[model samples]
Target: MKTIALTVATAALGTDAFADSSLPGMTGTDHVGFTVPSVDEAVTFSQDVIGCNVFYPLGPFSGGDSTWMADHLNVDAKAEIPTMQLVRCGYGANFEIFEYTAPDQDTKLPRNSDIGGHHIAFYTTDMDGAVSYLQDKGIEVLGNPTTMTDGPSAGETWVYFLAPWGMQLELVSYPDGKAYEAEYDERLWDPRP
Candidate 1:
């Protein structure tokens, strides 16, 4: 795969994008945390099904029965995270899965269009092979992958699917990189070596 580099002058991103003063200037992602109904099952799916490695053992944690917990996590102060475990997701972000129990926690899974409805997209080198593998494993692989026809993201392929728990997930692949990356000094999806 080939990647193109561009002059910084031509790549006109606003300075405000780098002006976050809260955490000693923003760096790359550390991890992505999400609550699951069962930490053990989530761990199994992540490791055995999704090919992530369990970086650590599950452990119990709580944010304490105070306004701080509720205000920050949007869960009841008395919420109890019975277990949590971290997993390394290939070359990208880590996953922080938790099994939480709270009086006000909603059991319904949210759709992508709903508020706070989100899906974690995993990058792959082979979109068709990945989709086929997932389908062979009896995973609910959604329809065929869609290739972008135009725009900055042109040349990438992606598809959406669901986990056993109904949480939406996505797979993305761009072996040749994207159109916008050619006009920027840095890249969001760097070509694999």
Candidate 2:
């Protein structure tokens, strides 16, 4: 495996080709958070079901923000609201999964049908294992891991699914992924190391 140096939170909040903010209630990467029905459930799926090695328990415990940016530059310095758990891929970026307290509730992304919206993607070396693990756990995949015939990833295989909390999640694999780390960018959604 190899390593890249961009801060997970920073890259997650950067501009895309169009330069519009792709994520809402987010800024400076770490400002992003996914509200799950249960923090423990979210942790299990990301760890055992998804085969990710858990990092600090319920961690980065402090210092993650979920406030929208006043300016695209970043979240406010004084921004502090709810707390979230940060997880990273075995070798890449970090993901922040938040559990609802009482006032907070699970919310939807802008919806893929709507513009400036999206789903979180997870990379897998074994797409079959990835699918099977989730399925065996009674987690149904929303759709098959279809092959992309479109844009930058004109020939990638991807499967879309939903987390217990209804947060959209995706699993993806490529033919020559051993060298995939070199092409890392703000778009790569990795698990916590």
Candidate 3:
């Protein structure tokens, strides 16, 4: 797998790269998908804690007597999806949360340094208020909010926290914008409205 990934990465670094060759008509990220332990608990945490709106529910899908699951989703052939949901926090992309049951499933949550480690960051205008809110709710905040003092992210303040189910999340604020905005006209995608 590492060799295959290296080959693909090497190929991508070649000079054939061009703006026009990118996915046609692609706009931006639509949603991020992940499998959770429980859909009900995830929905509650997303809505009550993270301030997300639960859009809808889906699934209870299984490919019985077929290889559809493995062929399409690259999961175990006998895997079953009991519940799934779509949620939107504020202004950026939505989240597709799934609850799956499989024979070979690994329930361990990966750390940020692990191969598939990931975290969701939400934007806010008030860093102090946001951090206080999380703390008041009995959430396990990793550390005090940090304000970048140098480089491109000089004006940004951020902090990391953990969900009840151990998913890593972050709250970031850059109300006056970052230092990089002064150096370049192009900007990273801003979730703030």
Pick the lDDT winner: 3
Cα error, candidate 1, residue 173 (Å): 0.7
Screening candidate 2 with a backbone cut-off below 3 angstroms (N, C-alpha, C), the clashing residue pairs are 9-29, 9-30, 87-192, 88-191, 88-192, 89-190, 89-191, 89-192
Instruction: List clash counts for every candidate, in order.
Output: 0, 8, 0
RMSD of model 1 against the true structure = 5.2
lDDT of 3: 0.88
lDDT values of the candidates?
A: 0.80, 0.61, 0.88
If ranked by TM-score, best first, what sequence of candidates would result? 3, 1, 2
Give the per-residue Cα lDDT of candidate 1 at 191.
Answer: 32
lDDT of 1 by residue, 18-106 (tens): 55547675744778998888888888888888899898856666777567668887778888778889998777678889888888889
Task: Quote model 1's TM-score.
Answer: 0.82
Candidate 3 Cα errors over 4 Å, as ranges: 1-21
Q: Write the per-residue lDDT of candidate 3 for residues 1-193, one digit (tens) a residue.
A: 5345535854785544234447865545789998889999999999998899899899899999899999999999999999899999888688999999999999999999999999999998888888899999998999899999899999999999999999999999998889999999767877666
Quick one: ranking by lDDT, best first? 3, 1, 2
TM-score: model 3 vs. ground truth: 0.88
TM-score of decoy 2: 0.58
